[model samples]
Target: MRPVFRLLSDELIERIISQARDILCDLGMEIHNDGVLSMLSDHGASVDSEKMHVYFTADIIDKALETAPDSVKLFDVMGRQTHDLTDHNVYFTPGSAAINILDPLSGEIRKPLTADYVEYAKLVSRLDNIASQSTAFIPSDVHEKISDSYRLFLSLLYCEKPVVTGAFTIDAFNVMKDLQLAVRGSADALKEKPLTIFSCCPTAPLKWSDVTSQNLVDCAKHFIPVEYISMPLSGFMAPVTLVGSLVQHTAETLSGVVLSQLTQPGTPIIYGGSPAAFDIRFETTPMGAVETQMMDCAYNEIGKYLNLPTQAYIALSDAKKLDAQAGLETSMGATLAALAGINNISGPGMLDFESCQSLEKLVVDNEICGMTLRLARGIEPKEDFPAIPIFEELLREKHLLIANHTRKHLRDEHYFPGRVIDRANSSRWEEEGSLTIGDRAKSEIARLQGEYEPSGLSGDILAEMTRLMRAEAARFGMARLPHEDL
Candidate 1:
């Protein structure tokens, strides 16, 4: 773990604490749904439906935080890798829930398709820094051929990295099971180390959709780690005040933890959210705004106050095009999230309010993630700090001592540049056609794909996946598999 900067000053933290205490004591949260209202009422919270306020004592909030796990392990499908979540580093991914694909060549947004999903997965798999592969986007056209779960199936087959997935429907739950079976090779393997699956439940005063709630319960019953996503929009879904928003988020996430723990005690659950404010003038959720940044920072504080592992939404932008604004927003958001010690930071390759995905942006965001991780690690002191003697010896010695011990140490300490990021002069750049960042990123992606080899699955397992996929295709009444051979 690295030392994190306290985003909130001591006075600010105290103020937040005082505000939270006030909210719990006075203005309380609203619980519109009966189940949630009953749960709160059973606890120490006082529910007033007419006033739309639910008050809780400090003890209840403390209990919820105490219940959450400090760490979680996300398993790789091949059973080859498990990302230990205890390390407080920022992890990046391409994008999530992108309905449109930005054409790398033309820069035009188009409805996503199955081919796009496969290609996106392959692109994500080739990147070294992307720690986990997410179903990058929801293909708009796959609805007719296969259910929404087709993305999960494609991600499992095409992605070799650890996966982050969820079930959108009951059929999708079955698809998740089949996908898990395909990855683990048997039901017994699943029982041994079930793959990590994160499911989101909408925050109150709205009710959790039946489909998403059932999926979370099912994932818990199966012992899969579930990340309860609480996306509360301040001034809209939640109260306008910051502390009010935090309480609402905390309450909703605690509700999710309670359900998961009740279904199966000690099931791993993370306190996660993508909360932000609804811009009053535009009536749009601004992901890159300072308000969004503050919201994430404050929510993170609430998560930490509970002493649980935390996750936050950052590294995303609302920029309509990739330019300086995009760079600034993405860089700042990602930097803050990393410094805040968020376990898993999403929204790397995302843009245009997260409605579009871009390959170029993914590579850029990945480099930023690398830089953020390096920043978090800070600098370690060299065991022997006395380099003055070596410098003195070199200064006395005449010409440059290139092979000196000090020189050797200097070379060992530096991070070398790669093909994508250039450290060249203007003349050298002109000779190379003054390539744009996107052009360089495309070359890098091509280079990686050319050199990359898929992690081999057993021939028997491969054949089984193929057979199951074909059967699934047949059941869906599709004439052919999405890919002739996955």
Candidate 2:
């Protein structure tokens, strides 16, 4: 069995779900979309039309949970299955929607350009540890209106991996969906083999913005997979206690499940969140705090309890630079999220409260992801029951270097990190100039970029995507998209 971590007992999980149900029935949620409100009203939910509030009964919640799938399957651009988001299986992905990127040479944070985004996509396509590529950071060169679909377009063009992305506006969703259809060749094919998981977030204190609510509805209609990101700030937007915050998270996420199921039964959705621990003194929400990590693990347990695939925005740091604090917080969060078996772990390469992306940090976190994946595999008996024979052979030979058993199991049993991790001894370290993690990461980045080849998508598909992007860009007065051949 895989190693497991839980912060809430069976009784506690049941109580939390019960309280969440009570909150929905009694307190209700304010949904800003009129169509969603009307749909909920049609489906037996009590609707306060004047107040824009929708109260769900227990039966409706039960039906929603029953209809939602227990797991979601993801495929790469070429229609190869990449992830089965079920059970205790875990996959790591870089965090999404950062506005700035950390420059490797100068070690300074600045707005990213199209070139920066291209390099990021190429580098992530080469990283084996990261299961999917996210729209990691936004490029300032593009029109602000097309930022959402533009990032998706760039990622799809340069990388073949499935994307973890989101939409910023209701209109952008159509363009983004069109881009996916262009790659998959048809709407039915795109639906049959999903190439992306869009993230839809609900506001804290039980609210859904117009854009996000509409995005959820659109995703449900198209048979696209989505992950609900409910961000509840403990002690501020939510109750101070972790359980209280979890109740709020559950209620908020459950409300989204209801919305999606009501739109279309059996719509794929992951029970995911990005809630943070609110720090009173600084009046800031810290994603790296121990409390935040704890809340992430606990909510994952609740998701599993409800028999749904899980996700969390843990394993990321809030530090501004690649320092000891960055490593400490990121490593701890990644380890915990892995042990908890979150279906899609999103936080690697994120910094400064999820506003910045660091290429160097991303390479380092790739190693962390490797180690955590090995940890989650747990120790299993692999031809070791007959230990006397192996030990006798070892005693006779004085070493197992050339042993057949040794050669076969070595790679599977041990996780050898890449150059980003300093595994050299003192003498070897000095001989290699004692490079810091950042220096090694920089070298790794250069090497990967040198190794990155074309994603091999057809020229016609590429042209169609560019045409769609150009049309969208022209609407915002953008004459040309930066870094494009056109």
Candidate 3:
């Protein structure tokens, strides 16, 4: 049996859902988009036009839940399926939309450029444990208007893995969608084999802004899967208690589900969020806080209870650097998230409360992810049920070094981590020069940069993607896109 972690029981989850429904029915949510308000109103939800508030009934919530897909499949640029987001399956991805990156050489955080993003994509393409790549950071070299699509463009050009990305504006969605079509060859083919998952966030305390609400509608219209990023800061924008924060999260996410389903029934969505536990003393929201990890695991239970796939921004740190705090928080969160069976775990390489990305942290976290995934697999009988034979051979041979069973099961039963994890003896380690984790990670990054290969997309497809990006860049007053080699 796989290892399982649960924070809420069946009764508690039911009560949480009940209370959330009551909130949607009574407190309601303020939707800033008039189009969404009209759509909900037409669909029989209670909408107040002037106030732009819409109330959802139990019937509406149930209908939305019924129509939303239980699983979302993701494919790479080659149309090869990468993830089947269902059951207790877990996948790791880099945390997204960081405004800054941790500079490896300077040991400081600063704005990233186009080359930084390209290196990031190349590194993620080589990370074995990270199942997908995110538009990890914003490159300041591009204009603000095209920043969203520009990241997506670079990801598609540099990596073959499926992307976890989003658009900041309604217009950017069209460009991002066109980039995917350029690779998939048609709208239907793109829909049939989704190349990316967009993250649509809702504001805290049960509200949806105009841009995010429209993004939800647009994604549904185009058959793109979305993960609702509900960020409710506890004791600040949300309630002081974990239960209260969950109620707010559920209300916000359920409202998104209703909107997406109404826009297009059977639209895929992951019941996801990035809620944090508030520290009153420091006046900060810590994703590594035990309460935050508990909430993430608890919400996954809620999502599974409703029979939908789930995602979380757990397994990352609030620390500014790749120090002990970063390792402690990131590893703990990753362990809990994996045991809880989060379908899409989006947090690795993220730091400083999700505002910064670190390549060094990413390589280290890849090892952490590998360990957690192994733990999630648990221990099962692997054709050794009749163990007497193996033990008898061990006694006779004095070792199992040359045993067939040992040779057959070695790779499957053990996870041999990369050079980042040290397993050498003191003498050997001293002989080779004792490198710190940071040093090993930097070496791994450089090695990956050298070993990186082109994405192998056809020349025609590459030209089309470039043409689309150039057109969007021109609109934002950029005469030449940075990183022409990309």
Instruction: Kindly give the number of clashing pairs for every candidate.
Output: 0, 0, 0
Give the worst 10-residue stretch by lDDT in candidate 1.
Answer: 409-418
lDDT of 3 at 476: 82
1-486: candidate 2 lDDT, tens digit per residue: 789988889899999999999999999999999999999988899999899998999988999999999989999888899999998889999999999999998988999989999999999999989999999999898888898889999999999999999999999999999999999999889888898999999999999999999999999998899999999999999999999999999999999999999899998999999999998999889999999999999999999999999999998999999888899999999999999999999999999999999999999999999999999999998889879999998999999998888999999999999989998999999999989888999999999989998788899999999999999999999888886852
lDDT per prediction?
0.69, 0.93, 0.93
Tens digit of per-residue lDDT, candidate 1, span 355-401: 88877777777778777777777766653568676667667775445
Instruction: After the best TM-score superposition of candidate 1, give how far the Cα of residue 278 lies from its true spot, in angstroms.
Output: 1.7
Candidate 3 C-alpha lDDT tens digits along 104-158: 8898889999999999999999999999999999999989989999999999999
Worst window of 10 by summed lDDT in candidate 3? 477-486
> What is the model-wide C-alpha lDDT for candidate 3?
0.93
| TM-score of every candidate relative to the true structure | 0.85, 0.99, 0.99
